[model samples]
Target: MSTLSTLKDRIGRYGVWSVGLRAEDPARRGQLAEAATELEQLGYGAVWLGGSSAARHAVPLLEATRTLTVGTSIQSIWDYDAETSAASFAEVDAAHPGRFLLGLGVSHAKLADQYRRPYSALVAYLDALDAAGVPADRRVLAALGPRTLELARDRAAGAVPYLVTAEHTAQARAILGPDPLLAPELKVILETDPSRARTLAREFLAMYLALPNYTNNFLRLGFTEDDLTNGGSDHLVDAVFAWGDETHIRDRINTFHEAGADHVALQVVTGGDRDTLPREEWRRLASLLG
Candidate 1:
């Protein structure tokens, strides 16, 4: 197990979350490494590979930076069995040691045909990880519910809850007590106009809106059916996304910190290409956060 005491110091107060970082093409490895290097220089504490990222996906990023921690925002249990996950963890850790975090998740029924009794399956997965000697403190859960949150507290390092509001972070902190990592991914739109920002947020949030895991969490956070419809209401969009001027964005991000998040993984939502890395936007955010 990792030294729980230093997890916060290792992860730091902020990270950059991006699906683009999980590029599988071998040709893009150099570019990805350069981006990782720049992110470390930019003062980001960590890099979370978005989507259903795996432990293998973290290797390149970890190799590209010395101090910056690299985590798979979630490596689905369905995609890799406990044995494979543990082996991958061992391989990566042997080279990078404490720089890798194995983020685990059950994914969704709609996305995985083998999905079954997610809670129970997640428990079993944890059990397997334990048997395979994967340290609890070196991992995290993509938890959104009470039971899973408790599981994160009891079985893993902490949680990396996605698509959640600040209030949920507060509740999760309460459940987590005064320890363990609480890093939630917050979507960001650099646009200042409400209409334009909401449009961009909606376009990106549309797919997640169709997932019950996220929608149910929204409902639990007091959002209504209408709020979940048509790519979410403006209120819902505004709550989950930081999309205004620099001052407003800073305040929005601070709310999560105030609510007890150890770190906030910022995911920039752009109007242009989704696959390409938003380096300019990242630079803007680095300056804004600084």
Candidate 2:
């Protein structure tokens, strides 16, 4: 079977995880392992590690769990070469077959400026990935626009779009056709209070708002200039981040599923300064969603 087909078969249901792994805290390494184990035990299909994490960083997390797919929702294409990444994928697949998904992205002009050649560089990168023998089905692209989405459909399994809504999922599904994988990340703030939830959501969204790629995607989704300004408008906030009690969150996830998302990776947003305490939020969401 093709690698994408294998992924679809393995991740039979849906999955959830934080946006990124919090490896900055040395004390929490054991807790992170335990959390991975618990997430797998709870029946969540895959755990998505985010962009900031290194390819090597996910090894321990994958080793700590069994039968749960560990994926990089994205690793920057600029930071790592396809030959090295493909070798790593081969190593991980040999060690834990059908348990690793590599999500790749072109990143934004601002971020890609460090390496130069923002657009053409990505196409070259994809060619290199092919030349290096990274099978199309084993990887996914972090795409939003039509061109990148088309490239993803032709070159990789599908697309892994972050900071998107069910509406965007439906659009992406239309672009990707019937066979390729379409997994989009949803941010959920599990708080009932509107003011507090929006505050927390905006705080998490601040950095992304500054980034051009996210802003351009939001614009493509019909968000006006004013809506993208000042962190984000109410409509933009509500659409992007699902905030409320358990039932509300459940419905939100189902919205994405119903919109034709193959998998939905949920990022729990808690109203706290310390990232360490997200374990409570993760457990709560796992119980609610699992």
Candidate 3:
């Protein structure tokens, strides 16, 4: 079967997106592996490591699960050059073929001192990855805009847009046409109360709001400056995040699929410390989906 077809089969309708899954510390390897195993057992087709994760961070999870596809939600172009990324992809794919998806992105200027000519740099990076033999089908991009989405369609497997609305998903699918993967990362808060949910969503979204890339995209999506103020307005929060009861959240997730997302990478926000795994929330999500 073709690699794209294999990806469609391997990554099911929904997957877990978590920064806690990144195995940066040696001591967390076992815990990370165990969590990955449970996620696989819970019937999640993939686990996307959040933050600027690379193929190396996916090693423990890939090792622990036989079929769960582990991917970097984004390994910034600034963080690792294409040659190093290609080597990591080669090393990981050799150990576990057809199981790793290299998700690349040009992160925000605030985070990367080297951020410049991002679009052009991304093209060059893809060119290098091509020369290094990283199959286009095995990689994805953290694309949010039209130009990058076009690059994702033409150069890579597909687009995995972060912090997008269903409206953006529809627009992206229109750009990508029918073939490549379109997996957008969605934040989920299991809370039912609007007051509590929006508060948590605002707290989580505050950092992203400061970044212009996201703000620009929000504007492009039809949100106003008012919507972007004070973390995020209710309308903006409600649009981007899936919250409330199980049924409500499920319906919200379905909107993305209806809008043309092949997979939704769900990141659960618990209004707690970032380090904890939030396994119970994951379990609830699995059951909710089921």
Candidate 4:
């Protein structure tokens, strides 16, 4: 079967990326499962399990939802080697088949004590998956800059870039050559009040701002050092996050689509809290996107 075909058109054009949807969370299993099923009923395309997820983490979600594509916003490469990762991937596929997609990434250097030669490590990892019979089409790389994006185009099914601007989506499409999937993770603040929304956004943005992988991408996308500093300039924050009411959110999603994103995984951020499931926001977004 073709790789994208396996992903299925059910992926539609939009989906949710959430850190709170972790399968490993001991307290939220039943809640998370019901939420995953609820998402499919809502007509949203996919649900990206964000924040250092493992392939094992995708299983319960897949078992909960029949057709919803549950992918890792990033399965941190630093945590799982290719062989072990591929084995876990196979386990999930055995139960759910094409209903799962693996989104692998070389996580931030500062976070991973063993981080080194990321591009080279990723290359070797992809090679291992290839040998393990993992289809390139069923996977995506969390690419940011040019070289990794190039690798994503050549080696994986496509790229799932996190915390990127619409312009970055356009640039990624140019590299991907019209066929590879371009699903950028877009942060959204559902509040209508600009000050409140920026306040909420900056809380989430502060941590990412410290990560060079993201800041460097901002630089590549024309953001200055000044823009990257001090909790991110308004221009930089505005570019990275979609804020202020439903109209603003829709416009931002459409901008990514217009710029070349085939699918956008909306990561909803409210008051910088990641523990609570944003079901209300997910429901609201479903109505707008549909």
Candidate 5:
């Protein structure tokens, strides 16, 4: 099997991305590990520590689970430099050979004070990673546009684009070609009421709307300026956050798979703190996806 195919086989196509995985307190870290172990036992392929996680954030999870591959959804280029990232990867790989994936990305300009010439910066980081002995097969780029996507294909194992539609997934797959892992973060709301779901979606999307990269991506996906105005249009919310029952969520994930995504990392959106583990929703989806 090709590198991506092998990694895909190991990681599985369904994974969970949760921002709460970074349990900094040494005391409660075991609880974090226990939660990850539960997911692995439940049969989800991998766990991606979301919210611009550092490489070390994945170590505890990898150390805890025997076979579950743990990765950073997008370790900020600004946060941990290539050398530190490589060092962290080395520590994890030494303990657990192939259970870690390094996810790299240039965060939003509004968020990162150092965000400048993202493409050039990403290339430089990848080059540094190469010099630091981090192989291309063990990393993924958080790409959203054509340039970054092409860079991801050339330099890394795959692209992990966030806040995107399945149509965007199809576009990215065509760009990355037949190889490279195409993993997209698919946010889902379990609410059945249309009004309630959209409200949650719009609220969740508000921050992203203020960010140019995401809004530009939406524009590229055929949404107008008005559609992006005031949170998001109903059409926009429906496309972005797959809401309603279990079948609806499954069908939406299938659309992404059909559109060429190798893995679909589900981010269960809810009113409560996303920093807390959404075990109930995850359990429900685990049953449904199975």
Candidate 6:
């Protein structure tokens, strides 16, 4: 089978583990490599690196883990040219064929404004990737709206919608049909205490609320303007973030699977000042999920 086809099959069979890469973390690089290795040891199918600058942050993690598939939950297409990105992809692919999935995005207009003409620039970028021989199936788009979803279907593997609810996953699945991959990132606080979990959830939601792309996505899913304001309403928080104990988090993951998500990438929210979060949480969760 083709690499993309094999990846789609693997995603269908085994769900994804997506982690964020925060620049603030001191042990970030080591933690990422360790996490990737541990997740692979735990038998998790894939590791998605988020908040990366194109493939720069992802390369080390990919180099560290042997068997696990690694991908950018998104690399801003505006940040790196297709030839450079494709060259990076080729270098990684040469070492680990079919193990790296390229998730590219137009990013938000606010962020894309630094480059000018966001949409047109993204189109030109995609054309460049095509010209550089990055196979359509080897890459996926970070899309949410209908138009971008259509573009993803035509030009890439599929869509990687971030911070989305299961309802939106179902809707996106319907729009993309059955063939293309639909792997949405789901945020989980993993705390048993409601108040504490909500606090962490809101803390994480704060920055995302300011991003228009995410706000508009929530709006399309029926959230009112009030729901988007002030660190998000309780209902909005509950809908976007899955909290509580392990059972609750697992149930939320299963909901997305049942809702027709080919793969659900789990972003585990951590507390305390430590960068790696004790590794025990990841170990326990991996055992529970595995």
Ranking by lDDT: 3, 1, 5, 4, 2, 6
Clashing pairs in 3: none
Candidate 2 segments whose C-alpha is farther than 4 A from its true place: 1-3, 19-28, 273-277
Q: Residue-wise lDDT of candidate 2 within 117-202, one digit each (tens)?
A: 65577788888878877778878888888888888889888988998878888998998997899888898898999999999988
lDDT of 3 by residue, 1-290 (tens): 86676798789999999999995899999999999999999999999999999999999999999999989989999999899999999999999998999999999999999889999999999999999999998999999999999999999999999999999999999999988899999999999999999999999999999999999999999999999998888999999999999999999999999999999999999998776799999999999999
Give per-residue CA lDDT, model 4, range 172-234, as digits (tens).
Answer: 999988778899999888888878887888878889988889888888788899997778788
Q: Top model by lDDT, which number?
A: 3
Runs of candidate 4 with Cα error greater than 4 angstroms are 5-8
Model 4: how far is 142 from its true place, Å? Answer: 0.2
The deviation in Å at residue 187 for candidate 1 is 0.4
lDDT per residue for candidate 6 within 1-290, as digits (tens), equals 76556777665534344445423445577876776677778776776666644555666667787767777878887777788999998887887777778888877766765757666777788899899888888888888888888888888888888889899889888888877888888877768898899888888788888888899899999999999888888899888787887788888888988887888777777765423433666676677686
lDDT minimum window of 10 residues, candidate 6: 15-24
lDDT value, candidate 5, whole model: 0.89
TM-score of 1: 0.98
Cα lDDT over the full model 6: 0.77
Error of 5 at 222 (Å): 0.9
Give TM-scores for every candidate, taking all chains together and pairing residue i with residue i: 0.98, 0.92, 0.99, 0.96, 0.98, 0.90
Over 69-159, each residue of candidate 5 has an lDDT whose tens digit, in order, gives 8888889999888899999888888888988989999989988999899889999999999999999999999999999999989999999
Q: Rate the local accuracy (lDDT) of all candidates.
A: 0.92, 0.80, 0.95, 0.86, 0.89, 0.77
Query: What would the per-residue lDDT of candidate 1 be over residues 1-290, giving only the tens digit for each residue?
Result: 33776988877899999999999999999999999999999999999998899887887888889999999988999988999999999999999988999999999989999999999999999999999999999999999999999999999999999988999999999998778889999999999999999999999999999999999998999999999888889999999999999999999999999999999999999977667899999999999999
* Candidate 1 segments whose C-alpha is farther than 4 A from its true place: none
Those runs of model 5 whose alpha carbons end farther than 4 Å from true positions after fitting are: none
